[model samples]
Target: MRVSVILPAKNESEGLGRVLPLLRSVLPEAEIVVVDDGSTDDTAEVAAAAGARVLSSPYSMGNGAAIKRGARAANGELLVFMDADGQHNPADIPLLLARIEAGFDMVVGARGASGQASTGRGLANAFYNRLATWMTGHRVLDLTSGFRVVRADRFREFLHLLPNGFSYPTTSTMAFFRSAYPVAFVSVDVVKRIGNGSHIRPLRDGVRFLLIIFKIATLYSPLKLFAPAGLLFFLVGLGYYGFTYSTMGRFTNMSLLLLSASVIIFLIGLVSEQITALTYTRPDRP
Candidate 1:
């Protein structure tokens, strides 16, 4: 199958200059597409100089948006996505492709502990991986790794589901699992990023980190996350009601509120579960 390597870059001219040549040397036949996310630097020029097809946006659209643009514009049967920064190694591309050839629908280059940019990011990723593993009942070595290879047709199917922000990898991985598509992980080590420092802000993106937890549950199985929460509220409310009835011989408003909240949360989960199921339905199906 023909392969397309896609790199979404923003002010990464230095890294692209290093990565693009390595990519060309490693996979001469594969199509290379570098998406310039409105970089003020010479990112587009550097990519073009390396003989990669360049796609430039007018303004900084977002990492996920650049990915979507590259995916839509690529012309290969297999799409390989890697970081534009120098962290991801081009030599490991073959490993991901091997897994895809082994009948897996997608293959991710799972990063080791040493590959993380920082200890806090590593810890956060560990939590995400555990949560995803529990939600999908699969061993998820890396839930947020950007280095992966997937069938273009299958990946395109979920373009609408991908956010324009930073968590496209999270959304795509969970979507594949929820749809029963085979996904595999191959261990890979990453180096320090080249060019400009990481664009992710600790303060702003930290909030997005929490949202990713909710996104994971809603993407795979909403009930798996919401059910336990509702049960917790129910149990607490029941205990409070028992204590109040024994002491005051009356049902208290606080207990009533908790009980009502339990029921509401559960009903919301039930509805959300149905909605989530519908999202995975094939468009051809009636």
Candidate 2:
């Protein structure tokens, strides 16, 4: 089977020089597509010189935008996405694709780097993943892995759902799992990034990452996210009314506000479910 490997590059021309060659050696028959995400450096030239088909974005769109662009330009049935920062190993491409071939809709590479980040960072991701998995009722082994292989046809449906940021993998995984698609994970070695520095700032990007998780959780199953909240609010409203009436023996306006908000949020969850269902429905489906 032909595989399309999409590398989203931004100011990584020098690094691409090494990554592209390694990929060429490992998966010779696969088509390599590099997306120049508005890089000021010679990323386009270097990618071309490395024998990669380059898709140029005139300006620096976000990482997910580059992925969507590269995927659209790819011609293979299976699409493998890798980071251009040299953290991913081309040698593991086959392992990822093997999982896909074995009948998984998506195959993710789970890096063996548990302490890869700081204690706080690692713990945060672990908690967030568990919470997301619990909310979606799907087993999520890795929520932030960029090294993955996905069916090009099913992967295309997630392009629009992808936010223009570094959390594309997490968002796509949640959506796929929410839709009941099978995802498998392969353990792989994690190498240090080859470039000078990482583009991520743990402090700023960490908050953004948390927000991304919330967005995905809400998008896939709003009720799963809001239902608990709605229940809490409903209970609070009822308690408040009972306490106020028992104390003063009179009805109050504040209880009305709390009850109203509870109903609104619950309605929001119902509306979100309908919209989400309509978004994925197909006439061809039984």
Candidate 3:
């Protein structure tokens, strides 16, 4: 099958200079598309000089936005997405592609603990993986790895569900599990990124990290998250009511409020489940 390797870059001219040539040496026949996400540097020129097809945005779009643009523009049967920050090794492309050929719809390169950029990031990813595993009832080795190869057609199916921000990998991974698509992971190591430091700011993206937790549940199965929450509220309400009846001999407003909240949360989960089901219905399906 034909393959397209997409690199999303922003002010990563130095990284691109190194990555592009290595990518060419590995998959010479594959279509290499460099998405220059409004870089002030010479990212586009560097990619062009190395014989990669360049797609440039006038202004900075987020990493996920660049990914969507590249996916739409690629004309390959398989789509390979990796960071242009020099952390993702080009040699690992074939390992992921092999899994794609083995009947998996998507294959992600899972990083070991040491591969994480920092201690905090590693811990955060560990939490995401565990939560996703519980949500999907399948072990998720890596829920946020950017290096992945997927069948182009299947990948594009979830394009509308993908966010235009940093959490695209998280969103897409959960979507695949929800849709029952076969996904696999292969362990890989990463090196320190070249050029400028990470674009992600801990203070700014912290809120986004929290949103990703909610997104994971909502994307795969909202009931998994909401049901437990509702149950907790119900238990608290029941306990409070029992206490009040034994002591004050009355059903208090606090008990009523807790019970009401429990019911409302469960109802919301039910509605969200239906909506989530509709989200996965293929447009081509009747």
Name the top lDDT candidate.
Answer: 1
Off by over 4 Å in 2: 113-115
lDDT of 3 by residue, 194-276 (tens): 99999999999999999999999999999888888999999999999999999999999999999999999999999999999
lDDT of 1 by residue, 1-286 (tens): 9999999999999999889889998899999999999999999999998899999999999999999999999999999999989899999999999999999999999999999889999999999999999999899999999999999999998999999999999999999998888999999989999978899989989999999999999999999988999999999999999999999999999999999999999999999999999999987843
Model 1, CA-based lDDT: 0.95
List ranges where model 1 is wrong by over 4 Å: none
Residue 200, model 2: lDDT of 77
Give the whole-model CA lDDT for all candidates, comma-separated: 0.95, 0.84, 0.94
lDDT of 2 by residue, 196-265 (tens): 5777788878779778767876767878877777888889988999999999997688888888888888
RMSD of each: 0.9, 1.7, 0.9
lDDT at residue 111 of model 2 (Cα atoms): 62
> What residue pairs clash in candidate 2, if any at all?
none
By summed lDDT, the worst window of 10 consecutive residues in model 1 runs over 277-286
Q: What is the lDDT ranking, best to worst?
A: 1, 3, 2
Error of 2 at 207 (Å): 4.5
